[model samples]
Target: NTFFQISDLEKKLEVEKEKTAEVSGDDDQEDKVSMVTLSGQEMSFESRGELEKAIKEMTSVVSKAVAAKEFRKADDTQKDVDALIKLREKLPSVFELEKQLKVMKQDMDKAIKAKKFALAEELHDDVEKLEMRLKTERALQPPPPKDLAGRDTHSVKSVPVVATVASAASVRSAATTPAKQPVLPKQPLEVSGPSSDKTVKHLRPSRPLSATEDESILSITQMLATKRGNAALLVGPTGGLAGILTDTDVTRRVVAKDIDPATTSVNEVMTPNPTCVTMGDSALDALSTMVE
Candidate 1:
């Protein structure tokens, strides 16, 4: 029985070889392929195997590009890799690095033009992004003269004209400005108990949300049900009301999407501070700001 099986395998190999020989030089013949399609509702990739393969391949591509000093290509491949990593809610650290590099480039351009060599030195020193070696090489090479510098032998204005304000407004102008006062009246603004025929307009955008207030979804929902409020006051890292969130925005970002509570980071949802407020505003001033 074993011998018969071996004989059959030999026969199969011979037949396959004959078929390959017969099909030789057939360029028009379509190559065999297997394709798999996926639904967004299902796994983003067709399977875990496919996803892993793609991740490893992208990483290898980027690594090779980096080794070869092809930094621009490496940066691009890094972006594609970062996008894939984000599908798992992982950080896109490389993307941030790319942004920093871009900002440094802009700063370098401005610094060179303005002759702010100190700033350019700072940017170059602080820039710890990929393609650093290549960029460093290019940076060491001096820039060409400006168009005007390269122009006619006889020039009307050989010397450049640059001017700057000697000084800003006087220190007294800032010192004499009055501080912001609180919005609370000498007496509390009265509201009818329980039953109200009319609603108070709370349109001022400066309302300070309390620090003691909970940051739960229940807290937010309850506020929306009772108040004609458009936004929630987000507390800052310093443990004070930081910024605000709005209902229309809530309807768009969270409530409508039903995003996973565990996976979704609210920091992205929360507003950042130094939020468009009048500087030196007091708590009462901030509240009165809302009432006004």
Candidate 2:
């Protein structure tokens, strides 16, 4: 005639408490003493201040996330806090829990009124996240809060250091090592192009940008403009410097053969290494080479 057996209901209630403990309790939390029933079953809830600390933690994460330019995370956090508040609204005494939501509300409002829309958005998102957490806390149970004074039982004490004994050794080495002799400075090389004003405007390529070894031939034409019987070789990766295919060379070879430069590479035209100077070579040596 009874709706359900009392002994059977007690056993079911005990099983529910165990399940809630596993979900909400970490290793550090104490076991629940009182079997308070909420949502038609027995499970413990955190004390007011401890509960507030958790909400603050969620909000703090929201703030840091917003600072890091991670908006998607901020959105998820907003969802959690929103759920908490909606559950808090359903509680009977509500008490400090409702006040916590109000403070969060005010903080959000101030941010919005100041037109600090980004900050406001983060705070608003944080409140919504707190609401969600509370909804979860109500559905499942949260661990019981610590003592009112929140005493830390862990002791602070100095760790003793063990001493290490070392064996003494006798010194037998001589005073010092001798100093090394100074080295003579290496001489600088001299590179001569021209002393006169003929090739002044022309730009010459000393080295190639890439490994192609092609020489840029611009300034040399302008530089050689005033010279009468002066013609010099443009040496590069191809061949002899003076072994050039100039207008004179082209007219004689390609034009006479009815061929085109587009069909030929600069290797078919430019002169290779004519003469090069070493670092020890003098200006007088340079003049003699030029004359040669």
Candidate 3:
């Protein structure tokens, strides 16, 4: 009986050794393959099958582009890749907002169960505010127009402009300023509340102007007055959103400097790289952006 038990124990030890050997082999094979990233760092793909698949796809595409001598095709692919990366980066903010909203709702429910009506009301209001923000976040920006076959689409990236918090007086000035003589084009302004449809983009009251930066401040002032808008979207020579000229800008920067509006250029006084919300953002998001 003792000899039989010893044989069984030896057999079990041999099986354990085989399993460890197999695992080590897998580790050795995983360490053999690595990828050099754009940041000049070496990344191992031992367990990332998706990354390996993406690399294979990229390699195949490069070979095809080289064979066809179609460099523009490669450029277009790069643009698509960049867009995907940007979209991926944006998704986390929405998810985080949703998580917070869920927590708020849970707290509100607890308050109601405990007969704390006032606390429940406050939590409910907070939840509604976060919900609006989440709606705005979910609104995706309209994709850029597709590039022409052989032409790379160059996009204009807005530079961060220096902005100051507007005081109560500045806000009042903006509220009172009217676009002067000729009426400017007006965009739709939709303000949604708890009772209305929540899917609509909260378009704030503003006007888009194609006037050059060298445009007279007087003309901009009149345009704002004419359109009943306190702010004008200044367009660059390239027809892109160059800057925002507002009543606050005029009051603090131009009027305070004692510069004649007729002689001064709008570009010289306008706030460059103004904060803006996309079409899908809610009214709360717009308000938060302006406040920030």
lDDT of each: 0.46, 0.41, 0.55
lDDT per residue as tens, model 1, 56-126: 57667766797789998888776665455344332212223355578878888899899999988887776
Model 3 backbone overlap count: 7
Clashing pairs in 3: 178-225, 179-224, 179-225, 179-226, 180-222, 180-225, 180-226
For all predicted structures, in order, the TM-scores are: 0.25, 0.19, 0.32
User: Evaluated with lDDT, which candidate comes out highest?
Assistant: 3
Best by TM-score: 3
Any idea how many clashes model 2 has? 25
**Model 2 TM-score?**
0.19
Q: Backbone clashes per model, in order?
A: 4, 25, 7
Give one digit per residue, the lDDT tens place, for model 2 in 58-99. 555655777787888876664453333223223311223345
- Lowest-scoring 10 consecutive residues by lDDT in candidate 3? 154-163
Off by over 4 Å in 2: 1-44, 90-292
